[model samples]
Target chain A: MNSEIVAIDDWNVPHKKSDGVRNRKDYLERLLKTERNMKDDAEPLVSWGFHHYFHGELTRQDLDLISKDRPILIIHRSFHEFIMNSRALSLFNITEDDLNHLSKEEKKFASLEEGHFSERGLIAVMPKVMKYLAAPQRLITGLQITENYFQENGITLIANPGSMYNPSIQKVKNYVFGDEDTPFKSLFIPSALYMLEHTDISNLLKTTEDHLSWGEGKVGFLPKHIKLFTDGAMYSQNMVLRDGYLDGHQGAWLMENDIFREAFKLYWDAGYQIHVHQNGDSGLDRLLDVLDENMKRNPREDHRTTVVHFGYSAFDQIDRMKKLGVIVSANPYYVSVLSDLYSREGVGYERSQQMVRLGDVDRAKIILSLHSDMPMAPASPLVLMHAAINRINYAHEVAGPNQRISALTALKGVTLNSAYVLGIENDYGSISPGKYANLTVLSDNPLSIDPLKIDKINVEATIVEGRPFK
Target chain B: MKNFIFVIALISFNVFSLCSNDRILVAKELVTLDDLYQDANAVYIKGNKFHSIGSKEDLIKKFPNIPVDHLYKDSVIVPGFIEHHVTSTASCNNNEF
Candidate 1:
């Protein structure tokens, strides 16, 4: 994932003052102008990066002003919810009659009057929308750019823990990322959530086993690796918290607790390394409980069940993680961008500053890795290391000084430890004999440099399999 | 005398053949991140794997005829970075049309 392409949307409208779109009026005008400029009138106007906090709550009525004729779908920044205008509803052939067929729980996520969809509701409409979103040429173009972006940032390998299971999309990915010319290799870890939604429960293991053959050249699936989700996105403040939000809003669960437990057990019994997308303390608590229960019922050593995006973890949770043998792949950029604002509005000063507490994780002697979550943060290892080491927030103040880690530890979080998290350390990671000749040449050593200057270090070139790429 | 000459010739031939394809990468410093050779300044590539790593002089002396690439004489080389998490669908969801 090279860049998150957020179209002319209002998520960052307040932040984009110079773009001449300060409020919803300016945003709507811009959207209308963009729609008018479209050469193909039939093409649905789809945009992403819509946050309710910044853009305010939107409805079909608000969007109808742009065009009641052309279809418009604006995805929430979390990618879990979306709002569609009246024409979009008509274009997708979704009506009140169709919505009436949904279950009570499903109906809660889908509002026909508002033309809004979230979670399961979003999943229900995704097939139709994905045909447009993941079009072959579009994915190919984005992946081509992604290849360059990876090479430019000195990344030799990237693993998508929860990749789409579309064979057509995989073919496109294989065409681009799997090409011999591409400098890096990509490993995919299939999502159990996707399997539950798309395939028969009995065929989950077989379906995952089939993905081993999905790999061609540089793109492949790692065997015995599966991903599951606990809560919603951190960016959208949808992550389920222990004590709820300051404004009395409740966070959402991506997967219900019972379902999450069932999936966790299936994978745990089958000896698969389960990687979970968890953001809040409540989510973590549920995850720990499931893990603890599974360990007691059927003991498995070195499970390496990793918690991805350790968004809001309590200090005690770290001890539990260590005991349960769970590692973490944290996104420190949450502190860099969301700390100040979230402190004031979302979780209060204490929890907000303590987000992505790698220092505590390290002190506990737990294996910690840092990631971009790419479009969630810039897909830059140096930048990730800088954030982890400095703990600097948007306001130039260190959010959690005690949570700051050493430069060497931060470096490992991006390299060796990251490879370890993926269970590919022997083949990749450090510069050693018999491992792939993958080296990232830099202008300065991240370990020896000033912690603040880490992000400024230039990537001179990259050597993959003993072949250098600039 | 003939057997002695043949033995010497065989040893020389073996040395030349081994060094023929090897390329010594000599940098000012090598952050090998390996326990045994943690602070080495040079590494010789045999095919696509590191054959040996040590000081520049030691590597050259050990593998005499191997060609040396000093392009990164001023740079630091670390393991190629690994990105542990990324969603391909999220990346391809660039609906910026």
Candidate 2:
């Protein structure tokens, strides 16, 4: 892998620092000039930002200079949608009529000439984009950069909840753990959805079997653990709901109902702990339906089928989740980031405020943990705890008042409950004897600190396996 | 010209000074968060592990000749906090490997 090829690549620095870009005009000005040194010319221009706040800010004309030569793909901050330039449209060779059918006139962010592609349109373009990103050097560098950032944040263990069966990940695993001496551990659980898309079930099962004990240094794979997405993201106004969004748009299921049930069964029967990525209430409904069916048929006890992201739910769902033995690994930062925005654009005030629903989950006695889902949110545990305890959004307003959990619960959401989600509770999470002495040495106790000040606490050091990481 | 009592006190100080090099630390409030001694004014460290935690007077009575090494009279100590969910893996673009 050549460093020169990577440093000048379009994917390099696709996201300009958010702080530097004050407004839409400033963003476009930066995008127009951003370029990369070519590596055989098949790559597209990728301008990235991390939030939906940049959604409508980009118009067709704003992409004039950037799209003139090579294809341009502007991945909005949401990761749910993307807008492509006219040149990008040529890759798929689709016209305006082809895209308009993806959404209604009122919601038509995707058009042929403007080349704004999202939802179905974005999904269509993903394969082509991934091909370029799949290049060996790009993947390695991306993981390396990600590893460095996480280490700086005092993270000692990382779980890739939804990963694809890329063999290069093995090389990455070797480089990170074997040669690079990464300070933390990495675990990968192949995305069941991606496996179904690329390979047959048998091969997927075989590959998983081989990687069951794949541990080198700190990198390892959880055998038989699978990830599936039930529905789309709420931030993009694309999550399925019982009543649907205020905009009158209906969210689509990621997998067909029958297919989801069958896929879940194959893994569930094989003794795999299934983790589903579900955001909307309707998505959750589909999951609950499957859980009930699985319970009646197989009747396994203490099976901790987990709901990852567990984004939105009605009050009734909490009791159901507990009864089904479905624990949650939620991104509390979602409420902090998306609640206010969703309130105005999609779900409305009542549902928007209660996105993560930590308090309800606590009252129902469901095991819950918080995750950064990084680059989705920073991989800082304290930051996640802050969002859980405070439930404050970007507007500095507490989005959900009663939904806030106590500092102890919030702290456990990051530590004890997180270990439970990973099924490493016996070895990690608390200060028990014989467990690895991996401690996140903080300047203040999160349990005793001011709720608002939790995120600001400084990390003094990280002790990994009884030795200081540094 | 000193009184006999002052001479006796000097002799006691010399006796206390004989036992030294015992690592001791004092804080405004030392919280072990341990089941046994919940709170203390000072702590003794044997190597890198906690040896004993108690008031300065009790520790002096227990280990008679130990001298205070470091005093953090304003700081609080508790068990090192553990972050349960933080990971070292870079999962960008929705954990797509």
Docking class of 1: acceptable
Q: Best candidate, TM-score-wise?
A: 1
- Give Cα-based local distance difference scores for all models: 0.81, 0.65
Which regions of candidate 2 deviate over 4 angstroms? A1-17, A20-23, A33-45, A50-54, A57-62, A86-125, A177-180, A201-204, A213-215, B1-97
Candidate 2, pairs of clashing residues: A50-A77, A51-A77, A157-B87, A158-B87, A415-B84
lDDT of 1 by residue, A208-278 (tens): 88888998998999989999999888877888998889999777778878788888898899999999999
Instruction: Encode model 2's per-residue lDDT on A157-249: one tens digit a residue.
Output: 677777555566566555765443676667777776666666676676675666665556666787767887788765566679998878797
Worst 10 contiguous positions by lDDT, candidate 2 chain A: A1-10
A211: Cα error in model 2, Å: 3.7
lDDT score for residue A57 of model 1: 78
